[model samples]
Target: MRIPRCYEPQPMNPGDSLMLGDNNVQHLARTLRMRAGDQVLLFNGDGQEFHATALEVDKRSMQVRIDSGEAPKRDSALQIHIGQSLSRGERMDYAVQKATELGMARMTPLFSERCEVKLNSERQDKRLRHWQQVAISACEQSLRCTVPQLDAPEPLDHWVRSVEADLKLVLHHHSATPLGDLPRPGSIALLIGPEGGLTEAEVQLAMASGFRPVALGPRVLRTETAPVVAQAILQSHWGDLAGN
Candidate 1:
């Protein structure tokens, strides 16, 4: 059976016995029904994977002994920081999840002119935590030792002006420029619009801030689907996805 992976946000050393967190404990003990002597993989977002054996397991808790740690070279060579416009319901969640699986280095939820999702401070914090957990879950499933950084939501204008990268791209269906024409970049900052799409002024503002408008194809893609397709194309072109 494939050993389940859990993310533990703490330093782990070989030979150290560690108590699993409540979330992980519940998942392993109740959900997975893992018992004593079952092996589990642990990662702390430190780009290292720890092999561990369950010493004790019950519905309430689980304790594991670390066997060893290995740092696998699984991270992508190209770094991508995406500025994704906030969408409603499962759309945003799907974008974050798929982006994490695609090896996005960082993601910042963006507020644009057409953005419809409204959240007060409390709801924003709640959503931030939820997205972080989503990224963690994706990491576990993708076997990514390092979890992608999910930044708190920020204005698109601010993100476009402040984000630094070797290359910056804003998805614009009207653009005649194709992605293949651009020079290869070690790092990229990508801007994606909301379901209603970015206003012409918003696109101009991003362009003035140094993001080049690039087209994926003739047909327009949904906000959530754009990031997945764009990142896959980018990764296949210049990142680790090509090798895989």
Candidate 2:
């Protein structure tokens, strides 16, 4: 059986016993129905995987004994930061989840002028937590040892001006440069618009802020689809998926 891996935030050392609480404990004890002696993999986003064995399982909590640590092979040479306009409903969630699986190091939800999804204070807080969980689940499913950092939602104007990356790209259907024309970099930043797409003015603003306008071939991809396709192509060309 494929053992389920859990992302634990606590510092772990070899031979240390750890106790899991909250939803994670409930899922392992009740949902997975895992019992004592079953092996589990644990990671703390420290770029290492912990080989652990279940010591106790109950409705209240689950405990595991850490055995040894093994440094995991790095996933990608490319460090990508995605600055995406916040779309409505599950569309944004899908984008965040897929980006995490594709090895984006950081994500910032951009609140653009054309963005239709507006969150009040309470809703924004709730949604941020939900998005964070989505990222965590993606890491578990993808077997990624490091979890991607999801930043607090910020306005597009402020975020675009502040993000520092070796290369910055704004997805535009009319832009001259295709992905191939750009210079390769160890780090890249991608700016994608919301459902209605970026307004012409916003596109101009992005261009003025040192973001190179680029196209993904001739096709116009949806807000959610663009990031996945772009990241896959980038990784295949310049990241871990390359040369294989």
Candidate lDDT (C-alpha), each? 0.94, 0.89
Q: Give lDDT tens digits, candidate 2, residues 81-157.
A: 99989988889999999999999999999998888888888998999999999998999899898988898889998
Winner by lDDT: 1
- Report the CA-based lDDT of candidate 1 relative to the real structure: 0.94
**Candidate with the greatest TM-score versus the true structure:** 1
RMSD per model, one decimal = 1.2, 1.3
Give a tens-digit lDDT track for model 1, residues 1-244.
9998889998999999989999998889999999999999999999999999999998898999999999999999899999999998799999999999999999999999999999899999999999999999999999999999999999999999999999999999999887668899999999999999999999999999999999899999999999999999999989998653
Off by over 4 Å in 1: none
